[model samples]
Target: MINAINLNSKLEIQAEAFIRFYYEETKKSAQQYKERLSEVAAEIRETGTYTHTKQELTFGAKVAWRNSAKCIGRLFWDSLEVFDERSAKTEEEIAAALLRHIEHATNGGRIRPTLTAFAPQKPEGSDIRIWNHQLIRYAGYRTPDGVVGDPASVELTEAIQRLGWTGQGTKYDVLPLVVQIGSRKPKWFPIPGEAVMEVKFEHPDIEELAGLGLQWYAVPILSDMALNVGGVRYTAAPFNGWYMGTEIGARNLADADRYDELPAIADLLDLDRSTNTTLWKDRALLELNSAVIHSFKTNGVSIVDHHTAAEQFMRFMKREQEQGRDVNARWSWLIPPMSPAATPVWHRNDLTEREIDPDYAPQERPY
Candidate 1:
């Protein structure tokens, strides 16, 4: 059985201690990956465009960008483990025990590198603010439900503990865990001797900016190295990841606008005339499909003949280029629905029935 408990004082203390241990381990791991860190930083400075610059860097942007690399490094040394105990023990004591075990596993019984202490804040009213550098910005929150399972709960609790201290009345607080795994996305490792914890948090509107439906949203799109020409890599500009959205289309348009000198390349790649409503949507879907296929192929799990398929795609693009025609791919209108009940068969917003009448029966209603 899974239990959900509000973090009390003792539990908070245990969480803080566990976070301290995590940070110490993370800092050490970061130090070890200093070379990789430098490379990633240099890559960003050289390749990344200035989305917003006002004489200095903003904390939010810095955190968003650098945290990805920092976490990759942290994963090399630290791992999360959950402990499931059937013994009769208070939640606080269990949390404390988990912290002790984490400490033991992390530093061989000694805390070396100290953690950066952070105080969680509970904002008042509907106008919630998050800090960017020293400036506060308004953000909305949408509470998401937790996955229904035992392991998920364990993961959730451990994740909460890993994020330092939590303040009373704070909602949507996340504990940032850093790991060094050389990848942008976080990889899940199974916790030995325990079920993973199920956790839920308020989903942010920023996620919608990813553009690939609500559920498929993820940040800082993963790279497609297979499509790289030399050391130069191409990715969907706005979202960076393979997923398509309005923002990504906007970026493509922006790139096309920069094709004044390379008109031939522009025509070859269908950069020009790609902004047409139907054409752009089609291209987005194809690019998205390519990205997905490439990811699966790279992971060595795809059934498709990746090398031959990639060669075919490249040849198609080349043929289009030769003919001075833009390589515009069409997207299918038939996007699969997320679930059976996800669709609305009909809608009458006004004077709508609030509940399904069980006594009325299904056959009683007109089909």
Candidate 2:
């Protein structure tokens, strides 16, 4: 019923409408997330234990905005199919439109710049003194494979190139960057076509740097090492416990008897059960379930069959519960806390060891 010209016209209109809707929604969502992040930053600042500047708060807000933007962008991409199916545009064209929309949505948003200090002047043969609480050092190298061994190898090099680094003159080139004394050694180097930069700092120093006015590109610190004291921390989930259902076992047995005829549903249920831990909240559980289902369907399994398998698994769980068996059982254990040993030295005074009380229980020591 539709000619090529008419279809093309419809495609253009749909593309425009999608982009407009996406841009507005993403911007609105980003702003909302940013405001919430600012509130958190303000709370941290009020504690006074950690000195956080306005710049640090702003940076945190920007990070929240970026994350929200990314989530919105993904949503837009997923919804593109509705537009694609209704219009006559090719898949590639639809994707391109979505990409452009994302670009427009993210452009000119709040950004934090990389902060570098001037090289501290040290007396000859004396170690350099770093004043700030944190110090970041950027090192350059040339490798054979043109790739760094670290996970950010490709991205680091691309960012460096974007910053206008070209390997023209020297066998080893140094960018206009500064290094701090007593920083940790880097584990990898960038290859010939690539370049690497290492950022080193403690939390206070990072907060200070984020506040400084600079026009450099700084990536949000997302590593676990960046989040914890000495990179050691523990997390707890409260809702972890046994789940019981009466219909579960019978349904499981029935499904097993017709295994080949019904398609292997055990694997699907096992995967779903394995993932439904209290460690993740309700929203995360739903998202993970959706992802698992999508993966199975993509691998040539029918959605209807997947749904049937899920229902059967639920019934099986119910039967197990009726038989006084746990459908799900979750437990938690404490991860050992981290502490550094005090510096050992010669003692001047003779000290006596204290005696333990007879009624006192022996406490277990953590390594």
Indicate which candidate wins on lDDT. 1
Write candidate 2's Cα lDDT for 1-367 as tens digits: 1111111233233322322333343454645444443443444345412222233322322222222211111111111111111121232332233223222322232211221111111222221211211111122343674322222223343344554554433322322221112233212222222222212211221233222111111112111111111111111000000101101111211223211111222232233334546322233223223332333233332222223433433454356467563322111100001110111111202212232110011111110
Give the deviation of candidate 2 from the true structure as CA RMSD: 29.7
What is the lDDT of every predicted structure here? 0.24, 0.24
What's each prediction's TM-score? 0.18, 0.17
lDDT of 2 at 159: 46
Evaluate model 2: give its lDDT: 0.24
**Backbone clash pairs in model 1 (N, Cα, C under 3 Å; residues 3+ apart or in different chains), count:** 25
The parts of candidate 2 lying over 4 Å away from their true place are 1-7, 19-151, 154-200, 203-367
Error of 1 at 218 (Å): 12
